[model samples]
Target: MIQKLSNGFKEIMIETIDKLKSSDKRIALAKIAKTYGDGGQTAVAETFHVSRDTIRKGSYELESGFPITDAFQARGRKKVEKGHLPHLLEDIQAIVDGQSQTDPSFNTTQLYTRMTIQEVRDQLVLQKGYQDADLPTNQTLNTKLHQLGYHLKKVQKTKPVKKIEETDAIFENLHATHEAYQGESNAVRLSFDTKDRVKIGPFSRGGKSRVRVEAADHDFGQTFLSLFGILDMSNEHVELTFTASKVTADLIADQIEAYVHKLRSQQEVDTLIINADNGPENNSRRTQFMKRMIEFAATYDIKVILAYYPPYHSKYNPIERVWAVLEQHWNGALLNTQEMVLGFAESMTWKKKHPSVTLEENTYETGKKVEKNVMDQYEKMIDRAKGIGKWFVEIHPHQCKAALYMGLKTQ
Candidate 1:
C-alpha cells in the first residue's frame, strides 16, 4: 500500500490521520488500509509506525462505522490474553478450578480455593505445558484469576463444621477402612447423605442475578423438600432422590434398599460400604435406621458397613461435596416449584456428568423408632468398631438374617 503511494500522498495520509481525533484517526487509517484490501493493516501499520492491533481495530471501526466498546479498548489497554494468548483464560480456569470447590455451607458463590498466585504459575508450567519464560508474571496471573471469579485467598484444606476430640481418629479410621474396602473387588464404596431442606416457593436466595424483578424479600415458603443423595465413589455415578415428606429414618433406609437393588441388577456387589455423617435420621444410635438396614442387608445377603464421619465433621462426607456443587448450580434462579427444583438439580454436573434425579412423592412419617426388644435383636447383628460405636458399625448379611429370622434366633 505504501509502495503505490507517491511521497506527497504518503505525507498527506500521515498528516490527516495524526491531526484527527482518536475515533476519526482510526476511521481515516482504516479507509486507507481498506483500499489496499486484505493484509493492508500490516502495511499501513508499518508505514504509520502503529501497532498492527491498532490498524485491526481501525478496520473493525470502518466496517461498523462505530468505535469499539470492548472491555480491552474501554480499559485503555489490550488484555494480555486477547492480544497474545487466546487460551490464557481457559488454561487459568482449568488449573485453578480443578483444585477449587464451592463453599460447604452454600452461603456464598465464591469458591474456597487452596491456591496462591505463585502456586497457580507453578501449576500452569507443570500442568498446562507452558514454559516458565512464556507465562505471565504473578501479578498478571492474580489479576486473571480474580477476573475469572476466583478469590485468591487461603482456603482451609477442607471446610469442617468444627474440630471434635475424635475428628482426627475418625478420619484416620474412615480413610484406612474405606481404602481397604475400595481396593477389594467385591466391595462397593459409597458416600450417602441428605442435604438441608430447601423451601419451595419464590423465596429470596442470597445470590445476585441480572433479573429486573427479584425473589420475595421474606422467605414465606411453608413447603420444604429434602434431597437424599447416594454416590458411588469408584465411578462418579450419583443418584438423587427428592421428597416433600420429612427425611425420616425409613426414607433413608428405603433409598439404600433401592440403591442395593440397582447394584445387584447391574453387577456383583457382595459388600456395600456406605460413608455417612451422624445426622439426626441415620446416626449410629438410631435404632429404627439400624433395624431397617439390618433387614435390608439380610434380604440382599450383602454385607453393609455403616461408616459415620465424626460429630460436627459432616464436611468430610463425600456427598456433602456434591450438595455444595448442586446448591451452586441452582442458586442464581428462583426455585419456586418442585419441577424447577428437580430440573435445576438434574441439569447440574458432577465431574462433568449429570446425576440421576428422582422425585419420591411418598410422604414418610417422622419419629419412627425401633423398640428396645426389637433393637436388641438387631444389636445381635451390628458389630460396632471397637469404642467408636456411633461412628462405625458392620452388619453381616447372614448374622443379621439369622438373628432377626422370624423375629427370633434361628435356633
Candidate 2:
C-alpha cells in the first residue's frame, strides 16, 4: 500500500512541475521553494525551501514559453570591459591649454560640437589605449578643467562712508545760511577761485595722430595768464579778471573792489558775501585791504562777509563748475595768442541773466611774500576770537548776523 501511494505522489509532483514550467512562473517557484517545510519531501523544496505546489505552478508557467530569467538579467547593460575616462580628461586638458594663449577663449560646448562623442570615445579607447566605460561626459570634463584653474573671473562692490560729526556741523551751518537768505533781493553770495598761471597760448603738441593742421606750426612755449574768478551763487553773476603773472593779495583786493563798484553802480544794495578756497592770497596783506573795505562798506550801510572753504576740498567751490564750463568750450583746442585766449574766456556766458565782470591785460608782480610772523599773528587772532563778536578787527552787520547764525559768538 505504501509503495502504491509513493508512486501516486511522484506522478502528482511531476504533473505540477510540468504545469509551472509551461506557465513560466520562475519567481513564484523560487518564492515557494524558499518557504517549503519538509526536507527533501518536495524536489525543489529542500534546495530552495519552497512548497511542492508552488514549484509545480512555476514549472507549468515556464513551459508556457515565458523567459523570465533572461528578461531580469537584461535590465542593465554590462559595463564596458575598459574605462576611457582618463584619456578623455587628457584630451580636455590639451584642448584648453592650446587655446589659452588665443585672443578669444573656447568652452567645452564648442569642443563637444566639433568632435562627436563616438569619435571621442574611439580616440580614448584606440588611439589613447583607454578603457570604454571610464569616459567622462562633456560637462564633467568642463568642471574638472575649472577645478584645475583654467577659466575664472571675480566681482567687487563698494559703499559710501557716512558723514562724521564735525563735517555734519559745518554742512548744517552752511545749509541754514543758504535757506535763510539765498533768494533775498539785496543779499549776494559769491563763490571765488583763482586759476593761476594757466598757459595762455599753444603749449603742448597734438599727441599720436599723424594728421596735422597748419595751426600746429604756431607754438608758444610756457606762457600763462592768471585768472581770478567769482561766481555769485545767489544772483548767478560771474566776475573774472586776468593778469600776466601769479595771483597776489593785491589782485584779489582789486577784483573785490571792482565787484563792489559794479554792484553800487547798478543801484543794487551791496550786501555781499565772498566765498573762496583757503589760498594764501585770499588771506594775505590784501586781507587788510579787504578788512578796510568791509569797514568802509559798513559806513555806507553795505555789508561784506568773508568765508573760506576747508583745505584740500576746493572742488566743492562753485567756481570749479564755471571752470568746467570754460574747459568744455575750449575742447582742448590750442589758443593761438593771449588776445584769443582772453576773448574766448570773456565770451563765455551763463544761461541765466547775471552780472559778470571780465578784466583783461591786468598787470601782476611776483616775489611779494606774506611774512610768517604776520600769518602766525593772524591765525592766533582768529583762534582767540573764535567765540566772541569782537574777534574780527572789522565786521559788517550782515557778517555779524551770519557769524551768529552759524552758532559762533563774536570773538
TM values, all candidates: 0.59, 0.47
Which candidate should be chosen as best, given TM-score against the real structure? 1
What is the model-wide C-alpha lDDT for candidate 1? 0.83
lDDT of 2 at 173: 48
lDDT of 2 by residue, 1-411 (tens): 212347667567546655664234464554444455343236465443456665655655555655434355556643222232324556655545543432133444222123433444565567666666555655554465555455432222333334433454444545565676776778778788887456655544342224443444555567777788978685677877877766776677677666767777766765666666657666423444444344345445666555555445578778988887776655455666777777777677765533354555656564454355444433333221132212122235554344334543211
- RMSD to true structure for each model, in Å: 19.6, 18.5
Question: Which whole-number lDDT from 0 to 100 does residue 49 have in model 1?
Answer: 81
- Model 2 / residue 308 / CA error / Å: 2.3
Candidate 2 stretches with Cα past 4 Å from truth are 1-165, 204-220, 284-300, 352-357, 360-394, 397-411
lDDT of 1 by residue, 1-411 (tens): 578789999898788778886767777788878888888888888888888777778878888878965454466667778776779899889888888887666887877577988988888888888888887788888888877888856554665557777777778889898778766877888899988898888876776667764788889668888889999997888999999887889998988888878877877889988898888898878878887888888888899998888887778788989988998877888889999999999999999999999999899988988778767767877898876777888999989777766557321
